[model samples]
Target: MTPRPGRADGCPAAAGQVPGPQAGDAPYARLDTEEFTATPHAVFEALRAEAAAVPVVVRGGIHAWLITRYDEARAVLADDRMAKDVRHWRDFHAGLVPFTGDVAVAARRNILSSDPPDHTRLREVLLSAFSPRRIELLRAQIARIAGDLLDRIAPRGRADLVAEFALPIPMTVICELFGVPADDRPGIRTWTEALFHGAAMERMAQASNEIDALLARVVEIRRADPGDDFTSALIVACDAGRISSEELASLLRAMLAGGNETTANLIGNAISALLQHPEALKLAVGEPRRWPQVIDEVLRWDAPIQNSLWRFATEDVEIGGRLIRRGDAVIVALSCANRDERAFAHAAAFDIARADRGHVSFGRGRHYCVGATLARLEAQIALPALFERLPDLRPAPGAALRYRQSTMSRGLISLPVQFAATPGRPAATCAS
Candidate 1:
């Protein structure tokens, strides 16, 4: 099946129409700023209060239209007029828009950056590798990974969950899944972190270069001694002319970044939510079946990723009373839409028991995260394993929660937690 139109896969490669150097300023502008990231609800509420589609500035002062209401957001996501490819954007082609080296590289050919026949072709191949059944099969391995992570920090009464647990688990899992050499993973992790956290163009370029260099080496290794892994499969595809070398590298970049970064944030966000709500934590701990519901609520209440990357307008179109000119960028505020009062009752409240929680955390329609099932599976296996090991876990007292300053991804830079100290448990054989 083809990817649904307009959905995001957690990659930041889309851009827009506003031409003014600085038409929008402060408060509403630059959603990546710490102030805006801290409490986006107020800003989104104001936007929703004003109109369904509102223009705003994002990182680097780029202007785009933001969709706040749920129905409007869904419509814009499913609308083919809102194109995923940034090349179609008028401002981008006019050279008014500037993409950093890494973003530009991603925009060239990644599945997250393509549309139509190209997007379908790219997605179908990767989907076969990341199918639901394949993801489900990794549950035991995911649990073991989680258990090992928790074991490492068990002796310490307090640990930065983000560093100790959240970040490494998915990074390790994705690397193992792709058959990336253990020695190369550290460099890959470093580069991936830089690409995500590097706000400046120069640093982003540096990180992108490092990643490309490493991927090139990995490609050679696969060519010399192929293995039964994604990297090898991609290489085989490359040899078969199913895809070009550049496209293979781009796909590898998308798979690594999209698969790992988003899952890491999802785990972090879910744990942070549970730490904040004791009753919810109790429910999760008392009833294993409730963990799925709890996770769904967490996905809705505090989405791992917030705004979708930019989607360029394929043509001049009117949406939600706003006349979006052809080539303008449209950003779906997934976080805001999840909490829209019109779409959800008591939208602001976080209740894990709520049955009607259908938030578009993984996105909606076609371009929905191809790794959505994998992300969910990782979280499902990881969170319970963590809680089961550290039942008394709670946020470290007086330790301020600091989130990474990012518009595309929502995550804590450091999630410090305190739990009862305990001896390390022997590696219990995980279920088959």
Candidate 2:
């Protein structure tokens, strides 16, 4: 459905209303600093304490409204007045701020950047390719992939989970699912990493170019010799005039990024949480079923993606008493929303058993992450298997946990842990 052109509420962006965030210094917090990236909770707490919606600066020196409270976040996400297309971003259109993704790629319809019928069509096609039945069938393969990864690292008493475990498993699974050739995956991985970690516009745009180029090559290969894979299915849709060639390529790129980056960081975040909270870890390990709850808490506690990309105001709209001008960018701070004291009791604390599992980690409504099920499935299978396979697994002594600095993402750069050294078991074998 198309976003509503304007808010019906009496709260209008009248001249008397305070204007949205300006380019210069703001009275409230600026979220673009590295300090915020490293330790953002305090800032979030203060921002939430102040108001539901606060004007803040993000990366690229862009000024926008950050939705901090849980209720406000849900409202803003579901509110029809908020639009997803970057063309609605006032600063980007005015050339005041750099664009977020590949202009060429975004010109073609993709889930991350498109709105309306294009987004609807692309999402339906994606659902067909990533059906529940297909995800269920891949469960065994995901487990085996996790087992293979742990097997390589179990021999060493200590391992960097981010490298050996967290990152590779998801990358491998997504690549296999898409039928992406092994040789092409390295570039894909590199380009995806750049998209998440790149601080400058040039680098992110460059990565987008590289990803589109590689995806174009892959599309040509899949079209020539089709297979029973996601890419092949999408190619079929493209051939039938259901979607454009650029849409197919752009969607493949979306899968490559979302399937791996989000999942990889999620696995990393879960492990870090478990190690820090022995009580939760013990309960999860003691009872296998609780792994889901534990993973759920981790999603709330430290979401893989901290803040959602910009959702622009289709017209002047009031969000939680603040008047947002037409075209002003708004970001849903999932991290803050999850830990909102108003939403959860002792919200700052991480309690796996906490009854409220309804955090916006995967977002809400139609724009919710399409890969949520797959991410949960991967974490649930991989997490338990790791603890069961490694004895006395704990963080490396004196190894300070470092997080990659990104305004939009919150994930451990590396999770160093030690466990009892043992003779590694042979990895499980499965059919192609």
On lDDT, the leading prediction is 2
Least accurate stretch of 10 residues (summed lDDT) in model 2? 1-10
- Across 186-283, the per-residue lDDT of candidate 2 in tens digits comes to 88878877777753667766777787788887878888988878899998888888888878887888888888888998999999988989998999
TM-score of 2: 0.91
Measured on C-alpha atoms, candidate 2 has an lDDT of 0.80
| Candidate 2 residue pairs in backbone clash | none
Cα TM-score of candidate 1: 0.90
lDDT digits (tens) for residues 53-115 of candidate 1: 776767655567888899988888888888888777665665555564334633666888888
Off by over 4 Å in 1: 1-32, 100-106, 427-432
lDDT (Cα atoms) of all candidates against the true structure: 0.77, 0.80
Q: Give the total clashing residue pairs for model 2.
A: 0
